[model samples]
Target: MKCVGLCPAFVVELWGVLEGLCCVRRLGFTKVELNTDSEAVGQLVKEGRVTSLLGNTLAKQRKLLEFDWIIDISHTYCEVNKCVDGLANFL
Candidate 1:
């Protein structure tokens, strides 16, 4: 986890997804299931809604998706990701 100072929650969530994708790509993973607890980020990615605020980040995410791999992005409840939640809280 990284501290992003102050920003909108969606930005932080999307950035985390982007970073994770890049890390997985570097690790030569061909298939990935990405679970995010942010419903707004999930909806934005699923609906392809590119707002001015999120356009660049979303574009990067889209490009990453275009790579030769299988990627599934889905929304999971925070309760389902207790470890991540605890880590975030610890930070």
Candidate 2:
């Protein structure tokens, strides 16, 4: 989430979610409890609709979900996401 200039925040946020899921999948973890600060990401993922600036990317995120596993996408306020948010900075 650092220095990702000019791109709409929703696009970047959705990209991060997709990439994070990819990593989790590679680790052989099928069930994932993912949390995001963006409500757009959650809504779009749960109910497919490419209405954002990065619709293609969002669509790709949906494509990545065609797996035989349970994935629960949740939303958290930035205030409660403090720990993970700080950790992302280190990465």
Considering every candidate listed, which one attains the maximal TM-score? 1
Q: List runs of model 1 lying over 4 Å from the truth.
A: none
- Give a tens-digit lDDT track for model 1, residues 1-91: 7777799887899899889998999999999999999988887776766788779888888888889999888999989889988987887
Question: Against the unseen true structure, what C-alpha lDDT does each candidate score?
Answer: 0.86, 0.80
Q: How many clashes (backbone N, Cα, C below 3 Å) per candidate?
A: 0, 0
Evaluated with lDDT, which candidate comes out highest?
1
**Residue 42 Cα positional deviation in candidate 1, in Å, after optimal superposition:** 1.1
Worst 10 residues of 2 by lDDT: 1-10
TM-score of candidate 2 relative to the true fold: 0.81
Tens digits of per-residue lDDT for model 2, 1-91:
3355778777678778878888888898978998989887888888867775667777777777778878998899878888987876677
TM-score of 1: 0.88
